[model samples]
Target: MRWINILLGLAVAGILGFYGIRELLADPVYFLELFLGGLVRGSIYALIALGYTMVYGIIQLINFAHGEIYMIGAMTALIVASVLGLWGWHSAVIAILAVVFAVVYSCAYGFTVEKIAYKPLRTAPRLSALISAIGMSLFLQNYVMLAQTPEFQPFESLIPDFAFWEPYAHIITSVELAIIITTVVVMILLGMLIKFTKIGKAMRATAQDKIMSSLVGINVNNVISTTFVVGSATAAIGGVLIACHVGQINFFIGFLAGLKAFIAAVLGGIGSVPGAVLGSLVLGISESFFTGYFWSEYEDVFAFTILVIILIFRPSGILGKHETQKV
Candidate 1:
């Protein structure tokens, strides 16, 4: 089965390469533009998917409320930016402050949610936790709607266009460049944290076995809460970047984005960090190419179709290992 999956993957790659080469030959500029656009989209998806994958790695729960955490991040940024704008603060300063507040608030919300909704249900049935997650999601959505109007709010781009980047501006804007760079940096830092830090080591051990980890000196609860905080921080960054890119946001924005990121996580292998990033890039690039070459209206159709195909062919995902339990 593993060999079959490999061969199938190779075949799919070959076919994609053939068409990609042909498209590039037909229109080099357009092809590169679409590819870059896909990278930007993929970067955003990867940020959110990282949060999904990490939390799942630690607790094996989907944490549906994560999307709301992301929404709160964006909303928090909007509010900060708006107030700063009114005060005539520097654009760079406003951007930095907004991001800081977003991350802080989102992290707080994530920790609180884990304690209130998930921690208490730790030993309960998985379905109970999942239902609680859904309820929490709905609660956050309505709470945000009531707190901040349901109407779409305009968001100004905080990323500044560099004068030196004028030549390449046509290929990709400053915002897109920032998103890609930020994702790369964040990924590298996360990799280092997981590989070197003490908390990172604890997270790894806990993921392997909760009881054994607890028996050994590691604080399982602390590790779990830390996981939520880290995931929320990454999702908050994604939220701010995406809000700046889209120029407008509403209370419901996170629902669709979160759903797409979840699909990306599953496509990449939900519990694997690298798998999440790879899957997001693949999904984003595929969506970009499909929308550019085929039908823009059917972009969502294409994404979900890809997810269905992946699910049918590789239930464990591209990088996920199939578990075998001893009877």
Candidate 2:
């Protein structure tokens, strides 16, 4: 099965490369631009993907309101940056602070959501829990819309100019650099924490069997809450990055971003960290290519198509393991 997956991956890469070469033959610079755009977009997807993977790992339940959680992050960051920038703070510093605050607030929000909407259902039927999740998602969305005007607002001030000198040309954009650096750094720190720390082991054990973990003296509730906090914080960072990249925000911003991130998590393997990153990059790059080479209208279709294909071929996902039920 592993060999089959590897062969399939190689085959897919070959097909993409062949098409890319053909496209390059027609217009080389365009291809390069598309490639770069894909990488940037992929980083954003990876950030959001982390949130989904982390929460799913510990709870085995999908927090449908996660996207709304992300929206809160972006909305909060936008408000902070706008107010602070008006007060004469450096735009870069304001943006950074906004991101930090957004993450912290989002983490708190995640904890609250778990406590209010999920904790009670921990011992309930799976179907009931799922319905509750959907309800929570809708409630959060409408709550945001009611609290703030639903109209889209420009987030231009949050993005600062960044530049780098390259041998070929000078490429600069603080927004782009910020997204890449933030995502990479966060992923590295997360990877290290999960791989080397005691808390990470607790998380893994809890994921494998919450009851067993509790029996072994782990605080199951604490671990689960921590997982939600970590996931929400990462999603908040993703929201800020997306808002900066798009230069605008609306109450509905989280819907699509959350959907894509969820798809990325499934693609990578829901319980696998590296899988989420890979899935996110694939989704991001696919969307970029669709928008760049084909039509923007097809971007969503392209993303969903990839998800469907992955599901058909690898039902457990690229890096997911099959679980056995205890009789």
> Which 10-residue window in model 1 sums to the lowest lDDT?
318-327
Once superposed on the true structure, which residue ranges of model 1 sit more than 4 Å away at CA?
1-11, 325-327
Model 2 alpha-carbon miss at residue 301, Å: 1.5
lDDT for model 2, please.
0.84
Tell me the tens digit of each residue's lDDT in model 2 across 152-204: 98986466553342333324356676788888999999999887898888998
Model 1, span 1-327: residue lDDT tens: 889978998998999899999999999999999999999999999999988999998898999999999999999999999999999999999999999999999999999999999999999998999999999999999999998999999999889889999999999999999999999999999999998999999999998889999999999999999999999999999999999999999999889889889889999988999999999998999999999999999988888898899888887787988766656
Largest lDDT belongs to which candidate? 1
> Which pairs of residues collide in candidate 2?
162-173, 162-174, 163-172, 268-275
